[model samples]
Target: MSGAAALSRPRWSRLLLAGLLVLGLTACASTKGPGSPGQKLDPWESWNRKVFNFNESVDEAVLKPVATAYSEVVPSPVRQGVDNFFGNVGDAWSAVNLFLQGRFKIGVQQTMRFAVNSTLGFAGVLDIASEAGLERHSEDLGKTFGRWGTGTGAYVVWPFFGPSSVRDSFALPFDRLASPALVLEGGNSKAAIIALQTINARANFLRAGEMLDGIALDKYTFIRDAYLTKRRSFEDDDEEDDYEVLTPETPANPQADR
Candidate 1:
């Protein structure tokens, strides 16, 4: 599992962009009336909110229930094994992105982790690498963009995918290639694997989603803020995965997706 893939808290990263928006909003309120709620950073706030709402609806109606059942019905060890299988698939790509971002030592370590897990770890149903001291690392293209000085662009909520900046969204297509499941020889096709990954990932965060339900006066804004906060904290993050990183394009509601 990725360091960022915790099932709780919606696991944010690369989200400092929105924290800046909060600052902007404060300044805007101090100078202008409260009616002027525009954020210079979030030029697409209106559109983003619409997509965010739609995604939430889908989650409530479909994703959340299915995930709840999966969690309830599946044994913890089995669920963990499933997650491990998927996560090892991601390490291959994360390693590549780590190298791309110029973190050669970490990249090499991750690559070795993948090799060991796929073989000795029984195709990653077990996390042998972590036991051997090679903890998982999340190095997606979004972080890659951040590393090379590409600023996180407008905050846009992808329709079914959740929060992302323009730059990160652009990398989704290329990142899809990194998923080993995409080329799996069995019955699971690329699309099916992606769907399973989404549901499993959503299940991991069920508790966090419920907690957000209790606290968010505006769910959309709350998720947006949490994600943006997580994103911004990317440079200084090193946490355990709640087992969500199914692929490189795993969308941003993110660090969770990692």
Candidate 2:
């Protein structure tokens, strides 16, 4: 294959994966019928279970060990700073999505939070905004779609990405585009930043994961229900109802931890 063709192949493969995800989720939603209660929301339970197992295998073989090492090697303060930096980046995108959802006041608040953190907090290495009472409003394109009345269709477990509904799966690409790391000039640099972020996030959730493993008999079902519940809370207009989950992509909410 030509050099250009080689480069384009991966891009095409990603697009194909995305296409299959959407189609599969849509089909699952359409195939719904009278059955077990779980089938109502997760019509593709069989397929989702397979993907969930794959994700767990990958996490056990790779992500978990790496995250464990990162947590042990990195000091607490430095890890917190890394979290703050990425959280600040997310705040910018949150503001945009809040505006798109016609939440002008919260959008402005999120914008201020990003501004304060970026400048006063030193490129978001410190969360001065939160200390200053500028609350973090964690909005994303998926939540925006929910706000726009898009139904959360058929829960699905994506390979590597974990739990999501049809609407969220569709919104994933757009949300990913908003990541600051992706805007960097080189693919390798972007990948490195993204990898760092993912590892940092997983490290943060190590305790929670352990707790989950102990308590949940069916880990897949437990995670799926928890994810769907959290996503539903986001769709509710009552901002006070907001909560956080231990997902790799979302920044940890300190208040929720408390």
Best by lDDT: 2
lDDT of 1 by residue, 104-186 (tens): 87788899999999999999999999999998887687777656555454566887767876656767676766665667777
* Each prediction's TM-score versus the true structure: 0.73, 0.79
Q: How close to the true structure is residue 185 of candidate 1, measured as C-alpha lDDT?
A: 75
Whole-model lDDT, candidate 2? 0.79
Alpha-carbon local distance difference test for all models: 0.69, 0.79
Instruction: List the pairs of residues colliding in candidate 2.
Output: none
Q: What is the clash count for each candidate, in the order shown?
A: 12, 0
Superposed Cα deviation of residue 227, candidate 1 (Å): 1.8
Model 1 score (lDDT): 0.69
Off by over 4 Å in 1: 1-40, 185-188, 235-258
